[model samples]
Target: MNSRRTALVVMAAMLGSAALADWARPTIKVSDSFKNFKLDAVFPKSFGDWRVDENLPVIVPPPDQQAQLDKIYNQTLARTYVNREGARVMLSVAYGGDQSDGLTVHVPDVCYVSQGFRMGETRDATLQVSGDIVIPVRHLMMTMGPRLEVVTYWVLMGDEATTSNTQRKWVSIRYGLKRQIPEGMLIRVSSINPEMDKAIPLHKDFINQLMLAMPENQRDRVIGRVSVKKDDSRS
Candidate 1:
């Protein structure tokens, strides 16, 4: 979708005050580009005989829109991720404050924080509003279950809300990451296990394709890159 319209829809999604259905779009300041050249430039590495969809969408919510997201996230929406072999890779939101930050929201039994990406260890980077969100390249990598040394672009859009006490609140959000993985990194979209020919459909098409395209012998090696646990201090 066009940037302007996407910004409007995001604004409407916010506005938790429930005071009005009408939403005033939040002001936006997009970063020039957070794509780390130091990382993206070092491409053509062992994609491990895999391929990643260049068209996959990678848009996340801004840190300033957290307050509004509380209600939606608190809902019963299932946590989603791709399962590689026996490992369960998840996309989760980690933050400080009370358990309310994660636990209070009540996650699905199947969902979990991606391994090696500890939410607690990430530095608290201040967002546009009063709070902060995690901003670590490794963290994004874990969330996607792929070892990527690619640049990332972060776009933030927030909806402003004022309480009866005249206090303002915001919700920081991340749709997901966007990066150009090595040319041939396979992702699981849909497949059947050879042992039993059991049907397996990973929620994400890119992940599914990557899983099937890569040979079994290389799966362990390719997935290994994401297995390393970067120190939380650096996360």
Candidate 2:
């Protein structure tokens, strides 16, 4: 009789938690904020010394995995760019209109792992995108036999940057309490380089230039708040 009573109590607690969660979830859609977020419109093909590679096309994932990506993301961009020196970088971006708890952007590590690549420990870093504009980014590497891919990436929940699940949850709670829903996206760049030291900085250079290429409003949408301190000294 005691065992059955304990089981009933546990079930009751679960049911109560579910009801509370449903009640706390935000319903108000902040879609207007991201209505102008078109992947093609923002990302440029030729930026800095880089130009799209006509010969080396971007790789599309397996049909099954791609189908899953299609369901989650409203838009995605994958392109390869080669510099004047012949160095190439691969850029991928995924954005969604409503990135609710169940429909968040998939991390690149998981995507690469599913494609049979061995992933390294992801390290957090910051990318200085021109003057006074710095954004948090992540660095990692993927390996498959002889091929090594060094990657730098970041995730955004609306204007708030959330790099991990914990951060995402906190952002979600903050939005939920305010009765607002936020969009989400994954911005990634990678290169096939044997040297991690060299490859990492190249990715940063690529990102910095790309962000610089974007117009103010378009760039602001991805980088969130642009709170730059004004120069009090007279020019």
Candidate 3:
């Protein structure tokens, strides 16, 4: 029986090594790269009725945590915006040149959990930016003691936007099979509000206005290609 167990362990080890070898093999080639785009320039300073709040305190991970994040992401931007109505929103975007099987963008759920915030309800949502231009997103509420926040985020895998981690993995594998390594970005927008019902609509309005203000060419980085059919009447 011991000898049989030893043989089984050996087989398992061999299988693990084979899988590691496959993942390490350079079978993927990056046909198109997003490395050249500047993330800072992609987002505007003032958009619609909102303006940048230079005095607003932006929360970021400490040096040790940030060091770890730096290894995963090539670039990151964090900013706060406020409108004349006294509403405020925080935006964060992280981009990586290689979003292959082993390396990928980190989602807010993981980050918030790591930061000691209790993750609340999470669901997939679609944001109608304009006439028939809907973008997929993940919405969740997070709380730490009495402080509550509503977060809306999305991951851009190449030109496709998805909220499912499974879908992101499939996209990476599909591109890997085609010998193409895809780049990806994670965009997160959040606001402090205990009332999720009202907070969500405000978040959507902020996104819509922000997207409208962004340059046409750079908008895809924040919100991936709109796949919904166009409403000619609205256009």
What TM-score do all the candidates reach, one by one?
A: 0.18, 0.83, 0.82
lDDT of 1 by residue, 1-235 (tens): 6999999877876755453333332222222122222212222212323333333343344454445445433211112233334322222222111111222222211122412322221111111211121211211111223332111111111111111111111122221112111111111112222211122122222233433455543333223222233223311
- The number of the candidate with the highest TM-score is 2
Q: Alpha carbon lDDT of residue 194, candidate 2?
A: 74
**For residues 1-41, what per-residue lDDT tens digits would candidate 2 score against the true structure?**
99999999999999999998888778876766556768898
Off by over 4 Å in 3: 1-32, 102-105, 229-235
Q: Which scores greater on TM-score, model 1 or model 2?
A: 2
Which structure among the candidates has the greatest lDDT? 3
Clashes of each: 33, 0, 0
lDDT of 2: 0.78
Q: Cα lDDT of model 1 overall?
A: 0.25
Candidates in order have lDDT scores of: 0.25, 0.78, 0.79
